[model samples]
Target: MINPLAQFALLLDADLMAAALQQHLPECQAGDWQVTGCEIQHPRYKTYRLAENRDRSFLSLVYHLRGRHPAETTAEQRILYARAYLGQRSQQAYTEAQANGETAIHLAELGMVGWRFPDDPAMPWLAELMDSRQIAELEQRPISTIEIVNYRPEIRCTARYRFAASETEPARVVYGKTYADERGRAVYTNLLTLQRQSVAAFVMPEALAYDAGHHTLWLEGLQGHMLTELDFTVGVAEKIPALAHALAAFHQVTPPPLLVITSQQQLKEWLKKADKLSHAYPTIQPALTGLFNELRQDCPEFEVLGLIHGDFHIDQLLVLADGRLALFDYDELAIGDPLQDLANFAADLYNYPYPVAVIDQLVQTLFTAYSAANHNQTDAQRFVWHLRGQLLTRAYRCFIQQKSAAPQRVADFIALALRPWPLAD
Candidate 1:
């Protein structure tokens, strides 16, 4: 009679263990050895030695039957029992994947499944499938069903599943890929149509333009809850009021869960090393260095530190079909002085006509909305201080953009930041 525990240890290899268990345990079926849990106690070759449990702990040893001899037990029986004991492990992995917004593709179900990509590469098989020709083939066909949709470029092309039907009308599916420029610098963008609905509802639908040279993609899909009907030209003066309204609404909403920056200090620290603007604006080095030194001294005091849309500007706001402004791009939402957001709006006003008036209106609208929501003015002075910092920071950003080889909106920003403030006059 083999020791049950010793025999169970040999069944770590799925194939070998399954065969042994099936043979020794006549009651066990092919799928009976479902892996309940597994842990790497030690890595021996390609396998991890694991502690396993079965449904019952009472059956520690074999019992005699019919007075002939004790029921013959083998190493395989022990392995099956161990596998069944570890059944809960897979569920834990599944739960983790869901929490991380990963798309869970059921292998048994051939249809497309949805999943969010996790930062870890623990699933090598899944990684392999993401870059395979199978995905390329799926891309060529009309979008029908999708197994996974990863928004971030780091996890692009990471998906699994079979196409629903060759003849089925493909759903508008957007896929993104990031590549370094000729100089080996990275550029990231959403694939075409992937973010169209979100952009349309929040940002300007008309502003969505594709640059084949830059490889920017915009996909059209599900529109968000907020709807708008206003239409205006890009960089038009007429759009400022609507734009401000949309931005104000965005500022009114609570921040999303994923925003990691909670304070002005934390925001500054993250920006200190982002370095994306370093190549374009060498002036940022001194400005940022000075900002860091004065951060504590210059940091504004605020009564209310509600969620702020970090990059609120004319370009970031959208006029939807219902005549209401919709704010999009929550990538930088965080807890901060609302004035910081207003400052960004003020910084963008110079790009179009009615610079001072537009800036003032936007500020007023944002403040009014914020004040109504929170009913506090404890740090009004502090808000103004932060606003000044934001203006200075915007100026630095403009200076950097101007220094870029092919500055797109730098001149506009510079003009906005340099405009004489109404209070100054």
Candidate 2:
């Protein structure tokens, strides 16, 4: 029998996707457009990131075919467009689109929940984020140029504002992040708290400003290298101890007022995520079901909870030009088992595609350094439980992104999670 999901699979193929997009997007007729990235919410909707080959301007196209509404309300397919550009053409598109009675973004909310894009009618502040004059006023400097550093459509966009040196002020770059919701305010508050704590050995990026109305947060952009890109064999390994010490300092600080996630809530969240992924990749349903059950059964009980980077990973780490380590992205800041942060960082170490021996060494070194810096506080059983859970989460991510060798990678992670904690020495 033909797989019903095959229609959506075509979106994953760039060449075929370009051809299909041309049917709806006249710009694709120029043959200079390609699908740069994609996301699938399976059985309901799919989103594709398209870029113009010449200008490199990015746009988002979302297809909504199924929703939780009445059949008549969602029977027909809907195509929604969003662009990162703030130009006359984009404005005209939206205005004329409204005039033409095009499918409004609100109609697709059932499938596009939590998605707030730059071109969203509700996000008028997006234009200000990219506005050169507005940025200059915010920075109190003569802005030279504005460039988008990163944009995860409907989620967040990070833009860099450059200020050329004048007779007085020196050249500098400022970073800004526009959120889809009010979460940016929380992150801004968390950074302020962390900065006041003066965690030794590491620095939190200075929170420049927070626009409550626009849901945008600005920070002092730094010149640095991501820890992930550093050479592990050469000298990066030496920084591992410093990184651990910094993390210890971070854990010592009391997190700002935030939700304290309990063991029961964490279990429910993981199972829910697994259930969602199962719809996207039915092949892994059995494995996921069994693994989640094992995770719940083996869940650890903790007495004291503290501030943890709920989504701690290597990518959130940076090595500044001045040799200070910079940690960022406190959106997932929460009160939970501190081991979750350690396990999360350790799990991310495996994403480097390093040999088993190298990863083992790095993880062992990290754990040892963290223990020493934090007054020899250690819990092997609890740590192992968190590590297994983190590995399972990693497997879910690897599979969700449709990464190469996803099944084997998932199996490898699951297998590792089931094994007894190594590096006990």
Candidate 3:
């Protein structure tokens, strides 16, 4: 049976969208351009993008998020697009957007909604959060441009711009992570709280604020850049100590806000992922099964020593000013065998476009520095066990992503998984 939501999404068909453009925007009609993609999969509104045939330039169609009509919080089922908050939630913000035509167009009630591209047309409720004196200073140095770098209604909305920030007051990045329903706003709210509390030891983008009503999070943009993009041929090994030192410092915090995952259930969950991967990709079945069987025999019961970055890799580290390294994305931060992080970091070396031997040395250097900073000797046995687990888990994930697992790649993971323990001298 055809799903109702799927049917609704089809309403904004390419032909229909082309017709709408012809009627409303003569300059942007299908006569000169074509509908190349339709991204309005959301049930609340329809959206599409037009591509000019002459130049291949694309123009985005705006979708007004306003619900069918205003509803009391009692009728949560029908509440839409931050509409329920017209009076009770953010009255001042609604008034501002309605006056500015960014939103809240009252054509005798719920009529038309859409953000004009290259304009402040969405999430007018941001004004409510920015009414403070500190934010009022923005009048002097206002944002000159707004560019949507990424957009997915249910996931997040990201924009970068000429943030004319001054030495005194800096501009903050705006973010909003959405959910199936607005009631699930606690996810980002809790994350912002965690970000605010973890600033002492970790280098991360600071969380400025989270407005539950608007489902937005303001973050202080870091001055540094992502390490993944850095060409670190010479200084790559040198930064291991900084990375290890920063990670060790972050773990030292008393009662850090994250879950501990040293339990057997966690290991079982990993095994299941491996089992599923082997079943899904029959090509790696024999090698993956052999590796899992060995892991089942070698798996150990370990205790948590400190916090571990569940997804420790070059991609998660940001190289800051003065050669300092800061970690990004705390959603995976957890308390586990610290070696879980070490091994994950080691296993991820395969991802880099570098010589395997060079990164192997770098991983050794990283673990050595980690031990030195930690002031505690690592149990080589446990380290080896986690190393194999991470390598196999990562291999499974690659398969899940449909990355072509050449015989060499599968062999590499299996070889690492079946390699000699304690990483012999």
Candidate 4:
């Protein structure tokens, strides 16, 4: 029996297939050009390089033409048709992967299959098709191996493997890193580190790596305890106290050094430069600008500029076996008013489902711990103002984004920000 892939190659080459395609797609034709080999380059379309002799060559394909069908003579219809075809093919490939028991296969990698039969002289064609640098790298690293242990589409890229070594068994290692898309939208990675074999564990969930292309290796996974199964949820009454204690412990540690941010004029210039770095939302830009302005104004009055977790949401906090809450993901860590950190915690509280009494209790516990740690250097009232300003700014940004897809929860949060719950006097 012929290989299924080989059958696919023949189908790709047959006149019948071309004829059928021509009925709907007149541009596609089965010429005397011969197909040596075909390989999957991307998920959208199969690329075929044909040669009449050893020198003269041409490329052609029958791909999904997106947009509307051509009514008269326009490229728009063909483009639309191609896109639709690619979408259908991508879905089909995903369905097949699910049927085969594969977990979260990337649709973009498997869609629109392409491969030449072994009988055909396609190896040379394949060699010629690769980029010069890629070809050189492949030759230089002929013995290298790649092992993919686990992968979640747009979430995590976990792998374990070894580079070529002479005397030793390939060094076994595991890596886990978060992934991002073309738009720079980031995903969270749970990095659980074990300091000892004790029952207590400190799991740190952070943006492990900024580069989406690079992988994160965790050697501890092979030898240390796997605490991924640990349960975080306990009695709702204790969560606030637990979180407050954790935040206090984290804030108590002396940071490396106080980072001096410039005045509002300088900050505006900095923001202008930062705006060019990525495609920030238009609504978010103004709010971020306002946030920087407020911080500059408040910085002189507030002496302490310590290490603060910039985005301390519920997801960033990990509860250990010993009942200690550890903070992780310091990618956005910056030296700012400690109240900014408090604001982040407050923002998280707004998002998470917990009683108002619990929030009050948590705030009181946090203030007490912070005051004790700082030797009464910091005032709670000033921090509250900072928190309020940050909240107002964040609320405005979220509200703008919500305008397009306004959910009830988001609407409620906006309302809450506008008319805040009065703090206990």
Best by lDDT: 2
lDDT by residue (265-374, candidate 4, tens digit) is 33354344324211223434444455445545544442555656667666555455565555544445555666567656665555445665566555565556556655
Query: What's model 4's TM-score?
Result: 0.42
Question: Which candidate, 3 or 4, has the higher TM-score?
Answer: 3
Off by over 4 Å in 3: 1-141, 145-153, 157-162, 165-200, 404-411, 421-425
Better of 2 and 3 by lDDT: 2
Encode model 1's per-residue lDDT on 242-304: one tens digit a residue: 554444455555444434344466446435432333433454445444544454564544345
Error of 4 at 10 (Å): 40
Error of 3 at 47 (Å): 29
The candidate maximizing TM-score is: 2
The TM-score measured for candidate 2 stands at 0.76
* lDDT by residue for model 3 (1-425), tens: 22222322223344554344334432233343322223332322211122222122111223332111122222211111222111122344456666765634221122223333222354444334334443335445655444444453334455443455778877644433322234324434444555656444557665555556656555555667677666656666767787887777766655455677864655687677666655445677787777777767766755766766677788777777866676655546666777787788888886677886777777778778888887857566676777788887766655433234433565577677776643534
lDDT of 2: 0.66
- Model 3 poorest ten-residue lDDT run: 76-85
lDDT of 1 at 372: 50
Candidate 3 backbone collisions, by pair: none
Alpha carbon lDDT of each predicted model: 0.39, 0.66, 0.54, 0.39
lDDT of 3 at 99: 77
